[model samples]
Target: MSGDRLTAEVVFDTSVVEDPGDAVLAGVARVLAGAAPAWADRMVAWSPEPRERREIDALATLPDVVRGRTRWATQDRHTGNVELRGATAELNVVVSVNSSPLARVGGRLLLSNGITLTGLREQVAGEPRTDWMRAVFGEICAATRPVWGALYSASEYRAKVMADGPVLRALGRDFSRHLPGLFAGNYFGAPYVGLIGERVFERIGAPAARKAADGWFVDVLHDPFAWRDDDSVTRNADLLAELGPECFFRKGAAEGRVTRAPDW
Candidate 1:
């Protein structure tokens, strides 16, 4: 079967330390270098047990897919106790796609930020049967959760919570007061905004759902749930600005590059 055509720009931010040790920095370096392919492999493999180790091995064996459809780049790893110039402490991975199941799945990943283990697990469990893609989604969700959790937990940073908190809180209040029918409407009855939307509707009623729909629509338009090259940079930067410098473990020396997917 022909694979879905997708292109993504991935960024990795390793942790910086005071008097960075060889082991730590080296490990971080390895993570930075290996994250994308590892993520891709896991996504494809979907099994935490390494099914056949085929996915991991595919990183080396499948050069065309790894190099052409996927592009991996990183910033210079800084040594010593260097103060970062950002709000959130994060290892950012941005994937841009035109038309692919990967895009839809990736949107969920981006929204979750790979931090909420429960959320990720829920997503993996809820996924529709799609053979390889389901496995890929599960693998990506499983592998990244721990990495993201470590980064956020260690630094005490909450990017999504901080960035979207006010909106969520206000929505919460709105839901408690009003019950609107529009709130129950969803994109094809599927949870576009995930459990958050459902919870809002449950607590507030219809009005809350309407507001949530509005919020979700606005979010999709402003951020556009669909893939675009470097589409996430502005949003990520905005989140970083809100989170502050200490949240970040390391800073990239350069901005990421994005390319449009070719029309088939």
Candidate 2:
């Protein structure tokens, strides 16, 4: 049977107070080195791209969105500065996982504003005989978790505010109002997750593929809107009803759960 391939693109805007190259490289190395077990079976292929000097300069110029929103620190490893500096880093990384041996994996990593790392993107082309691709996907997911987690953790306000339902709802409403402008260039650019989602769903079957796609979409939308609760869970439950309890939960119905009311 043919299976679907899953793709995800996650962009990280690192708020750097100090030189960011070494920290970014160290984090990437840790992920690739098996720091997250959730990724062990899922990663098909992954790599770190070189940083362009210009990109670093662009990152250094970003305006602070809010007072006290950005943090700066110093590192002696990546940059040769002796004193701490207020800087932010933008790292673009792509991860592709083939669900089927026949599926393809394409990835790219960029630093500063240029394509620092070249030749990292790959493609598998035609179908294969084995089913080992699933594990590869899992590994990629596991490896990237730390990076994402770190980014989210950087902003205590984002973390605290997003965790609350009322705040998330209000933020979602506000974000939806500006969705067009917020997502304009985001749709087709390098290191965008939407492209990854599209590729992954194309290879996988519709049901699971749609679920994954929608999940990622919702997550991204939420990031700007700050909406945290995932309503997809309820929607999924409703859809599963037609498939019956056995298939829905992947467990056969028990004797006590069935109702036997007659219309006599």
Candidate 3:
């Protein structure tokens, strides 16, 4: 979030889904069905390397051919897959603006991964993220209805991933992950932008919580990196704790944390 590139992610749990196909192609269909039921045909996926650039319209076919874990990346670089563990399967779908041509935006049912939840992140460069982006992300959060999710600066996210202990307890991703279910997944203290699913939203009652299509949205700054030293970070972190301290491991994680301000 140095004002040049901003990457944001949202993660949720898609384990034990509503449907898992019995055959390979059928499973693919099921996967597609949930890829982005809201956006429908707007979502698309492409095959991995060593394989030609094969684009698979996820919404066209998925989750119906095979009732097992799978992994696939889209043409836009978003990654999603149903992971298998012993006899259980979980979905991890990632949506991001970091990839080139950020057009595709759908996979699984939720985003991010820390442990029990899955994840999806977006990255955008050249400008401060717009409220429209945040709203769009909010819409995505509503669709996924994740237990909790966040939009953090890439640098801030990396920082928490490096310094925070229970961040896993807060958030999770599919590829490199742990089983953390704290709140807002990897949000060390409070996210620059945060979202709460229905269940928790009904409980926390944060005054600033805004009602979205399907979830509750919260934010501490206009743009994630807008201010590196604003006291609002601590105030926001305190508010999060005041609202739902048990939702996270370090309720005051964002306190005194200075991020790189955006140039815009």
Candidate 4:
């Protein structure tokens, strides 16, 4: 269960990148057209920003075409490091973003802004499809709308955010050491299922949550083998501690950060 490849990464943290000029890149080109137009019909292979300033062969010059017939990629008005290839091997995706994935911006704690999604497990051993990636990760969380996100794995997202057994201490962009970028103290950092944007706090510990076509969808496993059944992963970790403590920040909670769903 460890090796043999089975990664369905669809992570998100938000900063809405793509900045060499903006306009039509509108939130990561809708996550490369929601990750399925065979990721823009193959050919983009980027890696140019650290503040890339032209002349890397003029950065190939496709300026946001995306769909078919656009060989190179990233017309860069900002952010690069893309890569796509699909005809086989599970549409080889690798869009590691972070051209400034939120360093700081009026925060109390909770800071992180990654964006990852590696090739969707090219048939990772037996039973790989993992429920057909929950409708392409709910359309990549309705096109990059994630203040918090998850599809889970690597020990079922650390027993579904058990919060490092009272060891949580992330403070800033760590991505995942089992997630806990600190929203105050008890950093529950929501994601027992995935995609829970809009006002991410106002309490939603799951009752099959609801609403999606844009945001919110914590539908905890009716399938996906019930997370290998340990009584359905301990009832989805008691529905993520019934999302109390003012929608999770622990220790009397509610002090700062993620005031429900603050991003753009």
Local distance difference test, each candidate: 0.23, 0.24, 0.36, 0.41
lDDT by residue for model 2 over 1-264, one digit each (tens)?
Answer: 122222222322232223244343334334433422332222221222222121212221221111012222332222111111112111223322111211211321211111111111122212121112222222333433211111121122233223354544212111111111111001212222342334543443343322322222212221222222355334334433422222111222353443211111
* Cand. 4 TM to true fold: 0.29
Alpha carbon deviation, residue 257, candidate 2 (Å): 45
Give lDDT tens digits, candidate 4, residues 160-182: 34456578633332332223312
The Cα error of candidate 1 at residue 238, in Å, is 27
In candidate 4, which residue ranges exceed 4 Å CA deviation?
A: 1-7, 10-81, 103-115, 118-122, 125-127, 130-149, 152-234, 237-239, 242-264
For model 1 the local lDDT of residue 178 reads 17
Candidate 3 Cα errors over 4 Å, as ranges: 1-4, 16-53, 57-128, 164-207, 251-264
Worst 10 residues of 1 by lDDT: 179-188
Candidate ordering by TM-score (highest first)? 3, 4, 2, 1
Ranking of all candidate structures by their lDDT, best first: 4, 3, 2, 1
Model 3 TM-score on a 0 to 1 scale: 0.46
Tens digit of lDDT per residue, candidate 3, span 184-243?
Answer: 212221122232234454454455456555445656566555434557456556555544
Q: What's model 1's overall lDDT?
A: 0.23
lDDT winner: 4
By TM-score, the best candidate is 3
